[model samples]
Target: MIRAEIVKLYKTVHTWIGVSCGLALFIAFYAGALTMFQEPIARWASPPAVGVEAVSLEDAPRLLELVAAAYPEAREEGITLHLRGHENEPARVTWVEDEPHEAGQPHGHVHWWATLKPDGSLMAKQEEPSDLAEFINDVHMRIGIPNPWGSYFMGVVSLLYGVTLIAGVIVLLPSLAKDFLELRIGKNLKRMWLDAHNVVGITALPFHLVIAVTATAWGFGVPLWSAQESVIFGGKQKIAMAHDLERWRAPPPTGEAGAMMPPSQLLQRLNAQVPDFEPKVMVFRNFGDKAAAAKFAGAERGYVGDTRFGGVILSAVTGTLIKDNRASRQDLDRRVGTVILALHTGEYGGITIIWAYFFLGFSGAWLFYSGNLLWIETRRKKARKEGEVEQSRSTRLLGSATVGICLGCVAGLSLTIVAAKWLHGRVADLDAWHAYIYYAVFLGSITWAFAWGAARSAVHLTWLCAAFTVAIPLTTLLAWAFPMLGMWAHGSAATVGVDIVAFIGALCFAWVATATAWRVKNGPADSVWSIRKAEGRTAARQSVAIAAE
Candidate 1:
């Protein structure tokens, strides 16, 4: 027979660890889910521009010559030639120039895109691309907290999360076979929620394990690297990393100008040499010099985990292969690391895997939310008797926090996404405003939840979530209907998919709000989630005041 004390011990460990890390994990998973569609969302938010077709591949050589002659910095910095005509790509050629700043201070970059005018002249303009996708990714990585601290904070949380996963399995082990898949929906609300939570937890355990390991590794990556350099690598880590980086770096420019190979001929050469490589963008360094190189960044056919760390470097003048770092050619250690990263990000298996990860992310978020609710319910049962009217302070406080943080994240993300279209050209720095708007709504919702009780605030914030999410599609509709409003709506499937998903999300939030409102009104009065408890407390206070008067 299983010992009662052992079960109790593991249950306590699981509960405490889960509660401490629940809020951060919720934010991470929800934002992470959205990041599965990061590129699509970026395309959806991007404004129409010069477009990739404006400068055809045949005329790219002329454009390169013009840019090299006009802007000497670009030749050294490298110029990116966009192949895919995604909405986010402003033109056929783009590059970044470092902004002027004091030597010791932090510097910024100015983004520039160039295209050929109707005449044969060079038309270049500096414009910032939408960073909404990157901002969502930041939230996923850091939970909206600033860097260094955020990384350290999440590193600790991820460690605790892995512990909780182990403790949870131990706690459920005695009855694992009997209760694993049996989700009983009945009058016992806590039992029902517990059953549902267990089902999801056990089903997605593998995915969670992968996430926990990868997240912990990445969260403390810098510190870990430092430790490894000192301890394991004997201070040779940086040198090794520099050597690895040389594969991606272009050769130094020779002063003598060379006869540059045409981009069309270079592409043919690439096809002949590396038949399976599909390059998304060709980055040219030292464009007009003898040592000019073209770096092709893209995926090779039938290989996973090759998007970020794979590609080939070719001589820009002669179209000769200079370097090959494709997945098949990577060292075993580097290849394993790349695969682990891809597994965490769901970069393999194409669109179907992307959707699977999206749902898994949501499931993970709900697991934490449900775990919080179960904790509150367990406390309520232990703390209260049949005659008790007030819930425990601990449970009440946790309830309020749970409702506040989770719903606040939802409402904040929705509102910030809506602002992408609504405040585009109207704001001086739309990127900064994205941060401002998200934090404002997120903090405001938490304050509202504390001022009102969890019972009332959950309903209000959920409705707010629905409204803001619905506004995403409505904003797009307005842009399409009335172009005079200075907004745009791209008809591409990727952009339209964003609107459709948001509309569905809005409906789900509305349904949740309705259900929560009903439970607050009709559920048990002694519980923290019941509005009648708050009402009874107010009535008792009024009676005491009247008696005193």
Candidate 2:
């Protein structure tokens, strides 16, 4: 009965839907997995990770002055204060500066940052390590493509993924019971892998569904509202842009003389004025005037609490609360967005959540790998039996693609992070080096796949990639072994957070390395291979009725 249902679904929409979204899903999971360790990766990118000390409240005002001097025109653009620093964090006062320029040419723009000394004085030279993180984020967000192109591309792929999620669930809804928890190995190799795939799919159904929908929403958010709703927008992107928090322009100030309040005081005033709120960023809406409004935005990292000010607009000169949305909106909407963002990024539950996210993300990637293996396994003896000419070329290509693209991405990202750390200070154009490394690795991976047989390189490249990523945190640990490179233990939570995450990442990499070794040596001859269950005869039998429907 279960076999009949599986065959039926295969004859219907199941195969097509999965294959259609498979590529996009692969990219998203691969990059999103990297995003799981964003903060730690960020710390690793900060070369010679320096220890941080707590900034005294008394020192904020003086430090603000030094930062202001460094960025005199900060008033014209914006000045932001970062209240927290990690173990290897650089205390940089950072902001974006819109330079003056004529039409058709970009006015000069710089996302400026300056590292501060331990004594509360600003470092003479400026450094912007966060750019590396942002670049990785952009790649994840929009495939590192620019403007409408990248976004539009990502949006289309995400929509397809979302559709696959819905369609997949519908197809699987019927057999969700009998076939679940059934993993058969060796009766028929294809049957075994299909069962393993079904089991993994069913178990992670909730997570996979969430990723699809959230990625869709994130990718299509702007287009759905602005482009599609242009009639409502009166054909003006500016109005839509204003509604979107991401929109920014050099809004000129009235230039009238008025006593502007300091951010330190503003932060305190914000907490006092709005109970249960924390400020993420304190911004002067206008750089030059009395009516210059201050906007503070924040929310608990996970979807646990309200946004710091919940989109409040406040008087820059005085802490007059303007707009607050603490309790007015639908709870479901808030939770949905927050949870989606948190879960997709593994941020909803803090460290535990991050670790869990990393595990699933990798598993999701492996699911694809195994799925490909199953496909290839099916065609192998048949192709040889019928001769290559009679065999399907499509399956062969997908087989190559699955191995090549997936392993390629892993190699690319690993190389990119290493390049970020190694190339800093040595290169005149550090940011350019960052970009070059990522693209080179990505392109190189694809080329390698075509040149070398996909199957052979998949195993080799993954181990190499795993080693590269693991090296980052390991290098940091070794570098700090004796308080070398001006490193000393700082009794700060943020610093501790950095070190702890690195250790965890190292462990994860070790696990991957082991998995790689197992795959290479013993081989996943059957669909489901577990280190723990290697001894049993037909013991791998567990299936979800999910797909059997």
Candidate 3:
């Protein structure tokens, strides 16, 4: 087939894909970029909920007693233990139970937690729902809808993003060699836009492709498997849900009361026995009972592999060994899960990976924006050449769709963050405030998308997003300027981490706005909302020359 033939097929598929999933893709990528910083942002938004006092292994028993007394159901059901006293991550005890609610549903299961008080009592405050983080996550996951549907929608979007990525690279393969230092501008704006889009799309191919495939797999993995398994073979939903829940398991406690060694003693033993690892959490199940076993799990920080370390359960009283999660070295699944979380959450390599993901996220945003630009450029040239006073319906609609969808994400995020800050003391329902902000911004952005031209909307909303995004961290920092806000500060690494990240994010967005403004300042004859118009002519000529090649 001729090159034009390939281009034609690609153009048709690409336009359809973009037109169909462009808004969804824009929300996913834009929100995902923010989701990368979910933890830090959550920490930043909520005041420290746990204390960092180091609890001696000896005192864990007393603390456990208080926790049992405080939340008996949680104690009887299951509780998580944290032993790392590092500043970034304070130690805490958490118990989960169907926290009784008026709705008679177990939706808000109380994740009761408490930090180790210096006096040995649990010292934890109820963790507030983090609005901004949750909102961003909802956008990434399912646009905040209920399960299966949200997951299903996200799954489809992820698949579309994957297809578009693959098809894009295929279309760019022929022009891969010639364009190096090229971001063309000037006459035949459509071709220039096409070339620019191709360059960014091709250059960021690896990043987008990796995220697309992984995300789609994550989104639809279980759903597709379940559908196929149920349709083709004898399978059940109960089995699948059970399998999912099995990763979270705890041994049933024995009611028999027997003399058990203190948790402090057990910790001493764990340190002596597992000399190479550092304990993170110790769980004493069936405490003071015949079936009691104390498991010591830690982070093996100095190792090449996963940071997670397993535990050896003892008879609490007899100090007899029970089991080791890492004894067979087959605990790779748990570790794999951790690494995947680290990848998605920017936790593994610490701040370096975190910053890398941040910029890559913005670059991801730009990748989509340039695609919208190419759409406009391609259509505009035809309209101009035909001496048609106006663009066709499809072009107008595409432009509106692009502006509404992409800019809506930015606007929604801005409004959400602002609501987070403003509703701190006012609203009883913070999550509701966040939802309202998102819904309102999103709806308003769509209206703007249709009302304002895509170019105008992109420029205007981007500037607005820049301002709002900057305001969030800055307002927190400015609130810091008062010094009283320091009272809200804690030794928790998560809290400090959140504040620092917000400031850094603000600076980065400032850079984005400044650069975009400069580009707009220096461009061609016929562009309305951009400054890079000068590169259009050279870009168009080169594109034709290559096509003729």
Candidate 4:
């Protein structure tokens, strides 16, 4: 059995660490949950375009040749042949070219998609794809703070989070059997909340542990690499990384031009060789040269890794497998790394695992949110004297912050998602507008929370969350009903699923708002969550009644 003092010490450790890191973790987990369906979200946000089906696999050769002949730079930069026909793929063939800028300065790339026009001539346009999903991912990684600093902050938070997890487990060890799954839902609100938090924390312990470790590693990846170079690799880390990258790199082009193999034949060759490999896209370099190579980026069946990271490369001229870096062929170190990444990302086991991780992510976020509430409740009980009419300023401030940051993140993300279709063609840079809308709403909600106090702002922001989230589906509905709006509603299952999930989320938020409103009006007036200032009035009335008696 654990010692009482030891348990108390660990409890203190857990509380402080959790309180310090809970808000950031809530944002990370919430945004990270959305990213599980990043592809579907990307497809949902993408506008109608010349689809992958516009040019058949059989006709891909002609399209490639036309693009190569028209834009010689594409040959050197590599061209992508879309295979999955996802809604996000602008066309059967697409490539990106670096925008003109002075050397050694920060620059952007211009996205280009090529298709065969009605007259069989090359048709290409420079149109940027919707980056709403990527922005959400960025928020997940950086929590809306710019990189380097954000990464360093999250790294420290994740490290402390891991310590909190350990402290929590130690604190719970003595009562492990007795309180394992017991969730007491009764008049004792703090007891109920603590029970629920413990239950969820213990149940999803493994998942949380994986997340903590992976997040820390990734958050400090740059620093870790530098440390490894100095300490472990003796300055050979870059050389090692470069060598590892060689498996994915394409061969240099020969000056002499040669006949190119058709994309269909190359795929057939791919299938015969790597039967389990599903290619999403084939990236071609040196298209017309004798030494041309095509790198396939996709998933290998039953593998636990990202599609973008591993695949085979083929000689475009002879349809021969040039390099195989599929999961099965990966070196032990790479395979282990891939599995860890897949575990963190929920990339394995397909859709079922994705949904599992989705719910788990929300549960994790709630665990942190409730943890903060428990801390506030604990402090309130300790600081309050018998007839104290008000909560401590610290508790009140923390309460407002908790509600503001969490609900603000929710409302901001929902509204920004709704903006994807609404502002697509209307804005010169829809991507930049996404960031603008999210930050504006997020910061505004925080300010509102501080100004109005926690009780009122919680209800208000919860309602805002519901409204914004519901708008996601409503926006899609409007697009479907009115084509003149220059918006589109895709009929694909993936895109439709995004709308369905958002609608359900909106309903959940609405229910929470209603419950929160009821609590604010009717719950204990002495608490920060109660908007009514009835505590002082009640105490004075009791004294008057006692004197008369």
| Alpha-carbon local distance difference test for all models | 0.91, 0.61, 0.64, 0.92
Better of 3 and 4 by lDDT: 4
Compose the digit string of candidate 2's lDDT tens values, residues 1-549. 436675466434556656655655666677777677776667556654432234454565455556655666776666655655553345434566766778788675756555557665676334455466777777777766786677777777777666655655556667767787888877476788778877777788889877777777777777677665567656676755466443223234676756667666777787787765555556665533676666666653334434422445577777677655443342566556555565566644556767787778867776666666666667655665664323255664675576567666666666676666456666787777777877787777767655654445555566666676665555546546754343333334543454565456556656765765575456543212222223332342322244454
- What lDDT is obtained when candidate 3 is compared to the true structure? 0.64
Order the candidate numbers by TM-score, best to worst: 4, 1, 3, 2
lDDT of 4 by residue, 1-549 (tens): 788999999999999899889999999999999999999999999999989999999989999999999998999999999998899999999999999999999999999999999889999999999999999999999998998999999999998999999999999888889998999988787898899899999999999999999999999989998999999999688898899888888888878898888999999999999899888899999899999999999899888985757889999999999899998988898899989888899988889999999999999999999999898877767656665666788888999999999999999999999999999888899999999999999999999999999999999999999999999999999999999998899999999999999999999999999999999999866678887755555776799799989
Which parts of model 1 are misplaced by more than 4 Å? 1-3, 536-549
Question: Worst ten-residue run, lDDT, model 3?
Answer: 302-311
TM-score of 4: 0.97
Index of the highest-TM-score prediction: 4
Model 4, residue 161: displacement in angstroms? Answer: 0.9
Of 1 and 2, the candidate ahead on TM-score is 1
Which clashing pairs does model 4 show?
none
Candidate 2 Cα errors over 4 Å, as ranges: 1-12, 48-55, 65-72, 87-89, 113-125, 144-147, 184-188, 220-223, 230-254, 260-264, 284-289, 292-294, 300-313, 325-349, 381-396, 481-549
Of models 2 and 4, which has the larger lDDT?
A: 4
If scored against the real structure, what TM-score would every candidate get? 0.96, 0.76, 0.78, 0.97
Residue-by-residue lDDT tens digits, candidate 1, 1-549: 668898899999999999989999999999999999999999988988989999999999999899888888999999999999999999999999989998988999899999999899999999999989999999999999999989989999998999999988888889998997889988788898899889989989999988999999989999999999999999799999999999888999999999889888888999999988889899999999999999999988777788899999999999999999999999999999989988899877778999999999999999999999999888777766554567888888888899989999989988998898889999999999989999999899899988898899999999999999999889999999999988889999999999999999999999999999999999877778898997887887788899999
